[model samples]
Target: MSLFFKNYKPNTSIYNRQVLWRCNSTTATQNTEDEEEFRVLDILKKRDRQQKRVVRRIEVQPDRTTKMKPDQNWGNVWPGPRSFHPASVPLPLRQGYVPKGQAPPGKYANAELMKIPNFLHLTPPVIKTQCEAIKKFCTEWPKLLNSEEAIEKHYPVEIITSDYCHGSPSIRNPLARIVTLRIKLSSLNLDQHARDKFLRIVGDRYNETTDLVTLTADRCPVRKQNLDYVNYLLTASYHEAWTYEDWETEKTEQDMEYYNWDNNASKRSLVDWYLKVNNDDRSLTEEEYKAFDISVIPHGVEYKDAVYSLMNDGESDATIKNYATAVRKLLGLPVKVDRDV
Candidate 1:
């Protein structure tokens, strides 16, 4: 080749093409041998046709409520608290949001109907059955407390509490913890001093119109604890009201919040005036004079009552005028208007 075509060393492009072709052929042969050696046997053999898996869906039976007879016992179907189920209940119930002018969604698949608790189990028949079952455990009412008066007399205290039930994660209610204790002020057997002290201690808790004293306790987290707290408060208040302190004895008439006619100077003066006017020499006690029935005397008991009204109740114009007329009559003084006439 150097002698014939000295300038043309085998063309680089042609030589590359021949070398590439040879490399490609060698690679192909090696790949063919490798593929033949590693070939999976019986791949060409027809495989048994794979059996297709057919899914079968069994039809669900109709709801039991649909086949229920009119005389069927509903209590047996719903025995306790549970979410409302449209299919289990025979009624034609429907519940769900509906656009204006359209009927509500049927209860068949109503989430709205099923989300809330229902009292379907508490039918009249079910209630009667429950009562019959529980009747054996209950005792007869006491004969002594048969009447309302007797019951109130024996059990003066009234306690109020509330119970709540709902479809919530927690059963506890804040209002359930509150306990109210109520009793009539008259039923406490408190004397004037004790009654005054009790009223003062309780402040606005006493309702003057109804004479009811109410105490509420809710500081504790539990209902029982609050109830106990109210009971303790009631006992403490009763005992404290009955206790007499030295400071109370030191309280003078002027220091008294309300007027007392029994110990007033007006009463003593009136008694002395009455005795002097009657010329009764015997020194008689207030109780003895009251027993003497001063109403028989001219303007005697009337004058005393008028004075009491002026003192015990604050002096109103009408009471003051009445007291003046009564005093004039008791003293044998002519009435000013009568004298003028």
Candidate 2:
């Protein structure tokens, strides 16, 4: 029985050792499979990295304006009106509401500077080019209008008007309807009667110092209408001045604004006094008057001019002394000499 039991135990132990060996072999196989799977995954990851495109970071260059040549045509760069662009202009422009003593912000990203209109497109070269392009459409200036006097003589009337442009929605300007017509009073061919009538008709529209007649017309709604209205007013005024009336003939010296020496009673009285003082007959023949040569009389023309000035222009101390001297000369009176007593 002892021998049988010992043999059974040995068989059992052998069975146990076989099971342990199997378990160990299975674990080793699992570890080897895991390591092969890890190697495959690593190969796939390396292949994916190799297939991807190479991404190299490239640095962009600075603005072209920074490298602009001095001799480049600026007009071609900026040909028309546009908002200011700091990157496009090579100028050292800066704008900002900075504190006192501090430098203004750089032009880059400056909202205040970009908000306003820029005249950089209207440089001297651009202006010259534009002028040359449009010059072909312009008419030659008239040779007759070379001098100021010639221009005034040819174009007696001057018409003035205004034009305006803005960014507002409405393009019409109220001031554009106003038309001013200016002319010189001396330019009108009128005699004394017509000139006096014109002065009376025009009233305060005439400037005494400049002798300019200005007529402003804004009653009409349009510029052309106002211009036409002013022209009609001017024509009517000129015709009215030329027209003669019966009452005008009866206008006396008191009614006249200026004195007329030729038509005055003083002239007739002076002639009569001179004839009486010289003991000459009023019925003398032209030959006899020629023989006397009355024009040679001292202070004849000067006395008339002085008297006319005294009556028309307000009398002064100088005029009074001139009148006394003329009277003394005309009357052939002797001058009183100052004697030492």
Candidate 3:
């Protein structure tokens, strides 16, 4: 029957309807069952692959030299005989992948593949359980303390108000747990009493001082002195929050003032430069004359030495003193000159 069906072809001939019907029904049923079984097996294979991902192991050797043998692989993925050498081959029940210096794609997908074993084998079997508890606590507490939400959940009451403390967006209130968790997270030399002092400093900046606790229901204390409060206000303000426009205005004003001074000095120096150039006194140009600011620049700047010596001119002692005072006012300093006492 199989050979006849293999040789059969659907030519344009009307015959054998019953045989064709039986062949089609049997073939469809076999194909459907085969596909279903293949799918089930495929799912089971995937599950097996996932189960082998994070296999951990430890090793023991009788002597240090026996541990150094190179032929034995560390992990289960490599194939070899169960040869009993004294070398440090893995024991029956050490728990993460001891990759043979090379990891597979499927095994590497497990995030815990690189982590240490879930168990430990001790030389003295008595201490193994205690060591495990210590390891578990040391590993897990840090992961909790590193997160702010965990700290707040565990330690709700803070010694200080949480306002003055600031940190990254992920760490909303790091100050609240800064000291409580600091002992676990950081290695500062601070004892519990010192931590209390630090928390007080942080809280007091936000008007959370001891005095604020004494507020009455009916009456509020009116501020007697604005000076201290205003100073506090200024100190509390963040100085670097100036706008771009403010900086631009300041820079522009500075540039204009610098150029004005440069122009004025150039004009004053030109009066001397021209005298040296021409060897004759001549009227100055309109630009040079305009550059000299009369309100700001003094006439004595051109003849400051002559003005100083003229102080000892024959006049009353009060007049001479007034001249000395005027010179000091103009030069922005008192000049020491020899005069009869």
For all the candidates, what are their Cα RMSDs to the real structure?
8.4, 17.8, 28.8
Q: Considering summed lDDT, which 10 consecutive residues are worst modelled in model 1? A: 43-52
lDDT of 2 by residue, 32-144 (tens): 89888843367766787786689999999898797889999998889898888887899889887888999998888898787766789999988999999999999999987
Q: Which stretches of candidate 1 lie over 4 Å from their true place?
A: 1-49, 273-279, 282-341
Q: What tens digits encode model 1's per-residue C-alpha lDDT throughout 179-284?
A: 9999999899898788888988999999988989999999999999999999999999999999999898999889987666556666666666667876977787
> What is the descending TM-score order?
1, 2, 3
- Candidate 3's residue-wise lDDT over 28-100, tens digit each? 9999998888433577667877845686787653654345445532332222333232223343322245668
lDDT ranking, high to low: 1, 2, 3
Which window of 10 residues has the lowest lDDT sum in candidate 2? 285-294
Best by lDDT: 1
lDDT of residue 38 for candidate 1:
60
- Cα displacement (angstroms), candidate 1, residue 198, comes to 0.6
Residue 124 deviation, candidate 2, in Å?
Answer: 2.1
